[model samples]
Target chain A: MASPPTPLRAPEHQVAGHQAAEGRLGPLVDGAGLFFKPLQGDGRGDDEVSFYTLLSSLPSSSLPSSSFFPSFHGTRLLPASDGSGPHPHLALEDLVAEFSNPAIVDIKIGSRTWYPQASEDYIRKCFEKDQRTTSASLGFRISGIQIRDGSGAWKPDRGEIRRFSPRDVRIALRRFVSSDPRSDPDRALAAAVYGGADGVLAKLGELKRWFEEQTLFHFNSVSVLVVYERDAGATLGKGKVKVKLVDFAHVVEGKGVIDHNFLGGLCSLIRFISDVLTGLDENCI
Target chain B: MASPPTPLRAPEHQVAGHQAAEGRLGPLVDGAGLFFKPLQGDGRGDDEVSFYTLLSSLPSSSLPSSSFFPSFHGTRLLPASDGSGPHPHLALEDLVAEFSNPAIVDIKIGSRTWYPQASEDYIRKCFEKDQRTTSASLGFRISGIQIRDGSGAWKPDRGEIRRFSPRDVRIALRRFVSSDPRSDPDRALAAAVYGGADGVLAKLGELKRWFEEQTLFHFNSVSVLVVYERDAGATLGKGKVKVKLVDFAHVVEGKGVIDHNFLGGLCSLIRFISDVLTGLDENCI
Candidate 1:
């Protein structure tokens, strides 16, 4: 699918500054916690508004529970929007608060419209590369975010606010894997992402199918959040590690370039990650 | 711990009759769906009253996400409880409703106060026998119960409301395990019960520790509910099976023989099931 032109929007610097001012009391990412779209003409762009509506309409019971996305709490409308200043805010379940001793790794997958064309091409090429015979970066990026711990204290993990490119992800994963030979990090990672099954790739493929079946356009990139408890006893447990998908700002639905591209791009990205996870040769990727 | 004398209570026929009259609009078990204790002097005896209080006071977040017990929804007090005739009830998320093809097996696992001394002695002997050498019944019985389904409909399964003995569980589990060759039914069962860690005994030991840590008493017979999704693909997946503990009708607090007996009996029952699951040599059970 051909990529759609990056839509007209405020430059990143300006948007970030504006969002910082708007969400001073909220988290660093504006609307990152949102599960619903504020009503139309609420200041946010049309694309984001549409995305929230589609996401919120999904029945929570129908969705399989995964750690890839934070379990969404409902949306609350602050005093604005309906009038001149009121706005809607989403309250998400705090990730760290759910674990005994949490270690979270957030990787943003897929191409972003905001990224330069060259960077996007690089990611696409990496996704297409063969995994069995080659050792290369998976071409995704990682970011760090602070979440409150079980004690209600905010703690910033190592990779929290800035995006790490594919090279960064490989390096980080290698370090994490190498840090503890006893952990069987590859298997743990696989279990966290696709659950504990022998055929990790097949399960991920099925998950991708479920995603595409939703018919949601993906404009913004998708973030893959993996959380694991550092407790020694938890290393091999099935529920100890979780993988969740988050961030739906650029999603929409229709038989459009964006929708098709989202599915294709995500499928490629997932396959790439699966290859990295299953292929036993650590140096091979 | 010496077995506590069975607390004086109404005969089964009379108790059932009173419960039937009390729960006109509810299920056969008066508090089958309850999360809170009904107020005193309203009919339920002291044993049940204390059990509900202890169970309800538990912080849901502290409980590990397990399939054995139905996922807990919040508690609700229907009208009349304030001074009228309404009662408090627990809303639990349905297991069958959560999966595509769900099969639930509820096993009531501890000895009852009403058990004859001979039956109790047999149970004790089974517990003392080496799992590797004994094929004897663990002596505990399992009774099934009905629960709400995903479609908001109450469906009674084939074995629901019926009791199964150790022989029954063994037969059922053997059938489930034999039906799928690739899944290594024994390991799958262990994972479902204790979240997929090696050393099933160790995991159970840890779970027991968690239970004891809660400082709550266990007087009521413990029920071990196992749920499995019969998806063709799920035959080999780790998360497809779940096990939970339920039925807090006879709980109390403090260090007492009843509480000690509940723990010991449950430990023996779990070991029996674990032996059956992990030791595939049928004659070794």
Candidate 2:
């Protein structure tokens, strides 16, 4: 009754940052809203699967509202986009599907992506990477960014974003919101997308509040995915800008302790966005 | 087929603070979710009516979401509870109608309640009151508060709250969340209600973000009404704790200028609540 899934084209439509290096398996889409991410055969895939399953079973009251994460629609077996035969794929709501043209940024939060239970090699690898990026000092790093230009084409920055310094990260964020060169020079959309009721900052504040008290999981290497419509005349409305948690392969049980690592990084990100808002205001003055 | 409207008898259920002094007209309910607030025949009532009416006509995209204010249900002619015959009332959504034994606080935000267009006598009166209360220094003052005590009885603190100093305001807020003595010693409800998504702080943050950029109406003498269930076992859930903007009698057109007066008071209130949250965490430690 339905057509087989097709590979998600366009770099802007795919998960940006770390996935670029993985080069193993890419995600698929139904051309509809469903996003099918090929599950890794390693334990990482099982870990993510279990996390989503556990989240599904827990009372929603005990967790952040569903909007904070991609809506889980269970796992599905699908033909791999790479023609690697049928493989188990995670069925998730496409974060950017609703937008005509979207500007997206993938930020991996936390100063450390290694947990106490992680292998020594993994810890060392993550530590080196953290030190090389702005994450070590600023508690967050821009993993990837993609924004549409005046001509209605996507301009994605991945290599430079991954290596961005703190100042560069700030500039990258500004660029993410200020991309459509044809828009108003004042960049009102920045405030609307980053500071509105359902904007990225508000959503992050909600997640930070939950992280401050939640004793369920210690999320390592998780990404805060921000997406917003980049159409020339777009203004913030309901669901105009989306902020969601993705990539939970490194999650561990909280063991009744707060996730200070994640919380600190989140606070840093909030501060940066707040600064951007203030800067925008000062510039207008 | 419908029952006649009845006066809201319980003091805890009524709008606290300024209403206690007004004593002119009070709100009524149909035992349903609709709140019928008696409109003053004076210009103040017409001002509020105009604001609500204008708000109703605006596309929701152009204003803060309706949840920020109680859902306006248009005007209605109702028989006053005091047997004042039929009077025009602003029928609004009853914010606390669903809560069981709710703890409510009415905080009048802004340092200067008097507007440029107000009579000199009114300005002097408001200035004197602001100076006497914590509002002059702290940018906000507790207008009234009602919380359930250990015995499950309402404890209305009006006089003391109205005249609360900054220190006293902080204590009053702490007590508002920690009212149920039989609950967990750590006061998880404090973080849950004040820090959770859709909680008072989160909602205030949303309002602040909107105020920072919006050049619509300058809200003066308005109250940020906070309400939550004080039932011993109550936990945060959807629509559990409500934070709303109320009493727009002094609102004025912004004329393309930001409402710095209201914004300053909002930030101050946010700081105080953030302090309460931090102090709560220290006490638990």
Candidate 3:
């Protein structure tokens, strides 16, 4: 009953996921989401590096020190074990192989977030012969939202990304800020997007007015805030981004409130805080 | 208190909105969605035609149609003088030029959806120039989703189709079905994904299986039902699939829904039905 007509643009649902390897990873349902925090590939030594968790063929095994998932050079660590009971295990090599990306190099510097699929075994083997996830799971702070094709309506071969224009983001910002229009446009630009409740036609006018002005986004330690004015459509939708340390799933287990790595293990948001504080980078993890 | 440990994915947020465009199309947005339905382009009209609406100049005409978005071609009829609001708008030769989309085409086919943006000027022009929507609001079905950036972090410059290998699909499919060890593998396979209530991981596996098996669908004027098993993955987390339709916003608009021109929106399971229907396709349409 609380479903007040959603004004946000919908997520693309045209994806076809593959089956999970038996003993290695578990069964994958139609939609399995894994979150990752994009890590900066700084040249920190193993022990000096910060990350999330580490798995072991045995729990006592030491972690590699460096980050397994650098924004550039990523690591694929698996759960300590799989196929036991209430809590199964995830394999490591599978993680890296599944997340291998080929087209990352050709992306724009900082226009958006790039959340691709885990690579194929063949692709993974090409990069690292072992293709095994290491022991460990970490977490990160994401935009904290995931829209999946849980229903599988859209597909890549037969589907397409229609358009991402300024209006799309504009309307979104307006609808997001409807309940409480920001008094100071600059203070709550990005964060403003998270809250709103629009009425009928009358509210539409308020949203439209936002196009007449300019908007801004501030990403800091807390939540990111985006602020905008009325009728400034010229500069509302454009930016750059990356996946960081908190997004690592193997390192940290729980997500939002779900920690069932058994089916589709969640990528922890807390992982980023943990990694930043613990210095458990993957290379030496 | 009702948030399940692994609560289901509930998309109630509209990330990118024309917060302003709503006013432009305000009269059309009743409790239902757009008061018009886009007719599946028969390809009888122009090879390429784009439509635009603006928030400022919307005729503010009360919509008689309930939940129907209109579609327009080349022409204008004019608005009723008594409309709530009115505007003397600007003129653009081609909507796409204002949109700066020189090569865009409009036609709905296959398992795809679209979300194109229109400037207030262009939309206003459409409202004033073309009488089609002015007379009656029309609508378009989602043909595909557009992620501001799903390709390795939203780099519009790096235009690439994230592709999944056949092996990857298998991995995703197998992983999809491993959700329920209790139900019949085949029927649970059908129900777990296509039916019943399961976790996101299992649901993901269901979607993966649908793609690999090339399931087909059918609508009995009720809910959607999918049936397939050929290429279904035996387990989860294996194969090689590139992330397809990563942006979930489009799915909100495109997935699992069919529409009557200028009528009901986001009907249940259009994509799910398509998957089943495709299985019955001669060439795997």
RMSD of each: 26.2, 18.0, 27.5
* Per-prediction DockQ: 0.01, 0.01, 0.01
Better of 1 and 2 by DockQ: 2
Sorted on DockQ, best first, the list reads: 2, 3, 1
lDDT digits (tens) for residues A1-285 of candidate 3: 021122211112212121133443232211123311112223211211223222222122122222222222223222212344232222112121222110010001111111112235532342231111110111111122111122321111212211212222222223233322322222233332221231111122232122111111110111111112222333222211111122222122111111111111111111211222233212122
Candidate 3 yields a Cα-based lDDT of 0.21
All candidates' chain B TM-scores are: 0.54, 0.88, 0.19
lDDT by residue (tens digit), candidate 1, A178-225: 324233344444434343552334444555555433323434455556
TM-score of 2: 0.49
Candidate 1, residue B190: lDDT: 43
Model 2 chain A: worst 10 consecutive residues (lDDT sum): A15-24
lDDT of residue B232 for candidate 3: 32
In candidate 1 the C-alpha lDDT for residue A71 amounts to 50
Docking class of 3: incorrect
Off by over 4 Å in 1: A1-25, A28-42, A45-50, A58-73, A77-87, A114-139, A145-165, A177-195, A198-203, A233-236, A256-258, A279-285, B1-285
* lDDT tens digits, residue span A1-285, model 2: 233456553233664632422345677666678777778876888898899999889887888874687888888887665666777878888778788877778899876677657887997799778778877555678876677656764344566566787666666666666745334334446778788788778898898778756757888899899988877677667777888888988999865444656765676677677766667434322
Off by over 4 Å in 2: A1-12, A15-24, A152-156, A179-186, A280-285, B1-285
Global lDDT of each candidate: 0.40, 0.72, 0.21
